[model samples]
Target: MRHVDELADRARALLTPGSRRVLGIAGPPGAGKSTLAAAVVDALGGQAALVLMDGFHLADAELRRLGRADRKGAPDTFDAYGYGALLARLRAPRHGETVYAPSFERELEQPLAGALPVPPDVPLVVTEGNYLLLDEEPWSSAVRPLLDEVWWVAVDDTVRVERLVARHVRFGRTEAEARAWVLRSDEANARRAAPGRDRADVVVDLDSGRVTPSAAPA
Candidate 1:
């Protein structure tokens, strides 16, 4: 595994004085974006906080009501405009301002509001999710402008599948169910995630744990 400490160190270095330097960690499902985001905040102590894009996911009931529950994690299932506005707020942070953000609960399959809070003093805000680099309407133009740097976590497809299976199992799926879900749903998201890698400011080989400068899409 690539040493996570190096990534955290580099992310810390990218922070500018005053307000948060939104560092986005984008990748497909099971690529370790959430785990890596937690690690970054853990490594940085008080200097960082986490804002997950998963928090923007529409609730399962809402999805079901819309007849899109089976298509969860698809781009249309989120509040893209709301997320964009939140990023804009983070960019021009005020003293004593504390912004509350939502977090996803796998068991509940919904977003829990106020789960993550960003205080005025935190210099770095690490926001991780699958679609941060997505180049589609609203979402594509939403986040990139507010970010100081963007890093995409890349891993081998095999390792990613394994991680996804383990994650599903950990979150309460049976072994067979986990594998099926990974193949059926997660892979679709992964394929959609591929193009975003090219748009990343830094491409991180999470499997090997190496970071390389990458060109943005023309």
Candidate 2:
């Protein structure tokens, strides 16, 4: 595993004295994007902040209205345009004032607006999500342009799947339901996100904790 200190150093290098820079961590479900992002922020102390794409998740009512409740984790289930707008705002903050961002509440499965505040003095903002590197419309157009660098978190498929199942169970699903959800929902999103690995500036193998540069996309 690449040490958290190493990740912090790389993140630090992206900062400018008076400007904000966004570093993105992208990966499939259970690839440890959140964990790694937290570690990097912790290592950077108060100089860094985190903004999560999961916060833009469409509410359950909205999902049900769209007939997409069963496909909740899929890209279309989020407010891609809104997320992109938030990134834009973060990049060009007004009057060096503190900016607030929304956060997702896992237990409630809803987004709470203005749940996180990114202070103006913080030069580095670390954002993590499954679709940060996705090449699809709206998302590709909106997200990629704002990020200074995006690292893909890679892990063994089996380990990733096991972690997904365990996470579902911990969040209130029965063992059988958790396994089913992993296979039926999370796995589909994983496959959808896999191709983005080719577009990453770096790839972090969570299984071995090693970070490597990926060949530029063809």
Best by TM-score: 2
lDDT of each: 0.85, 0.92
The local distance difference test score of model 1 is 0.85
Residue 22, candidate 2: how far off, in angstroms? 0.4
**Candidate 1 local lDDT, 16-56, one digit each (tens):** 77646889999998888888889888999999989989999
Candidate 2's residue-wise lDDT over 1-218, tens digit each? 36888888889999898789999999999999999999999899999999999999999999999999998999999999999999999998767599999999988989999998999888889999999989998889999999999999999999999998888888899999999988999999999999999999999987787888778952
lDDT of 1 at 81: 84
lDDT value for model 2: 0.92
RMSD, one per candidate, in order: 1.7, 1.3
